[model samples]
Target chain A: QQQVKQSPQSLIVQKGGISIINCAYENTAFDYFPWYQQFPGKGPALLITIRPDVSEKKEGRFTISFNKSAKQFSLHIMDSQPGDSATYFCAASMRNDYKLSFGAGTTVTVRA
Target chain B: DTAVSQTPKYLVTQMGNDKSIKCEQNLGHDTMYWYKQDSKKFLKIMFSYNNKELIINETVPNRFSPKSPDKAHLNLHINSLELGDSAVYFCASSSAGGAETQYFGPGTRLLVL
Candidate 1:
């Protein structure tokens, strides 16, 4: 069973457009939610993360909207650029737990 | 400097052969983990070690063994490799403990022929 589920297995967005990816989790014990971005031939890097205590968190052009009640979260990239094209993965884990359950990854392509 | 690094970026070996992948981290993190990514891009956790102590071991087969000689290094050894063992393995490290941000290595692509 997949603990985390992400939508839009693949997405295409125009330059300067907004790119959004959504994810949901079934485990209520998961308190930490993180998003990762991966480029071709490279490992994934942490993008942004949020906890259930807050409804949203923004860093630069990236924003994470979280809904604890619904067990859902979404990542929005404002003014998406061509360089932002890559794969994104959403993961959830509980505090003090070493295991992280990752979502099936979404490949994003930005058209110039 | 690379925070996490894995050796043998690509490996192709025959079935039943024994192979080992080595990983090292320079971040001085107290926790390290091993993850496997399948062709469908599904990433799954295999094992986790903290301060050279085994902490997490998933439902992986007994043929797979993880060794940590010290706090800075973790290695995976597989005996009698099977075709299904083909996948990309990644090593990650985090400061403090679990539920923290993790730094990942580039990855090691293994192909069991």
Candidate 2:
């Protein structure tokens, strides 16, 4: 069973536009939510992360809006650029847990 | 320097062959994990090791075994490889306590024909 579910398997946006990806999880034990960005032929890198304590976390153009009660979180990329085009994954893990449940992943395409 | 590194970036072998993938972390982390990504891009945890000890072992097949010789190295050995085993395997590492902020290797793409 997939612990985390993500929507919009793939999306395309124009440069300077906004790209949003949404994810939800049923596991309430999860506390740490992280978003990873992966490029072709490369490993997924930690783009940003958030704790349940906060409702939202933003780092530069990447923002993660989290709703603890709703068990949902979304990633928003402002001013989307071609460089930001890649696969994005949302993952959730419990505190002190070694396993991270990942979503199916979303492929974002930015057109220049 | 690569925080996490894996040997054999690509492996192509026949079915029923035995193979091994090695992983090393230079970040001085104590926890290491192996994850497999299928063709559909679904990632799942296979195993985890902490301080050279087995911690988490998911519901994977018995043909797959993980060995942690030391805190810095974790290797996976697969016997009687099947075509379903063809996928991308990634190695990751993180600090001991928090166990978050994992750094991943470039990944090893394995193809069993």
Candidate 3:
């Protein structure tokens, strides 16, 4: 069973446009929500993360909006660029549990 | 210097053979993890170690074993490899605790024929 579910398996956005990916989780114990970006043939890198205490966290053009009450979170990329084309994975984990439960993944493409 | 490095970036072995992937981190992190990424690009954590002690084992097969000789080194050994085991294995390290930022290695692509 997939603990975290992500929508729009693939996304295509024009450069400078807004690209959004949504995720939902059923585990209430999950307090940490992190987004990872992976390029082809490379390991995943942490993009942005949010805790249940914060509704939103922004890093540069990447932002993570988290709703603890709804058990949902979303990633927003502002000014999408061609270099932003990659796979994005949304993950959740409890404070005590070190293992992260990841969503299937979303492939993002930004056309210049 | 690379934070996390894995040796034998590509491994191709026949079924029933044994193989091992070695990972080392220079970041001096106390926690290390091994993740497997399948064709669908789903990253799954197989094992985690903190300070050279096993912390998390995620119902992986018995054939897969992880050994941490030291806090900075973690290695994965597989016995009787199967075709289904073909995937890219990544090693990552985190400081402070498991909930901290994680740095990942490039990855080791393994193929079991």
- The TM-scores of all predictions, comma-separated, are 0.97, 0.97, 0.96
lDDT of 2 by residue, A26-103 (tens): 989898899999998888999999998899998999999999889999999999999999999999998878888899
Per-residue lDDT of B1-113 in model 1, one digit per residue for the tens?
A: 88999998999999999999999999999899999999888888999999999999999999999999999999999999999999999999998554799999999999999
**Which prediction has more favorable TM-score, 1 or 3?**
1
Model 3 per-residue lDDT tens digits across residues B1-93: 999999889999999999999999999899999999999998889999999999989989999999999999999999999999999999999
Q: In lDDT terms, how accurate is model 1?
A: 0.94
Ten contiguous residues minimizing lDDT sum, candidate 1 chain A: A92-101
| Candidate 2 ranges with C-alpha deviation above 4 Å | B97-99
DockQ of every candidate structure = 0.80, 0.67, 0.70
Interface RMSD of each: 1.1, 1.7, 1.4
- Cα lDDT listed for each candidate: 0.94, 0.93, 0.92
Best by lDDT: 1
Q: Give the CA lDDT, 0 to 100, for residue B65 in model 2.
A: 99
lDDT of 1 by residue, A1-112 (tens): 8899999899999999999999999889999999999998899999998999999999998999999889999999999999999999999999978888899999999999
- CAPRI rating of model 2: medium
How much is A20 displaced in model 3, in angstroms?
0.8
Ranking by DockQ: 1, 3, 2
- lDDT accuracy of residue A8 in candidate 1: 86
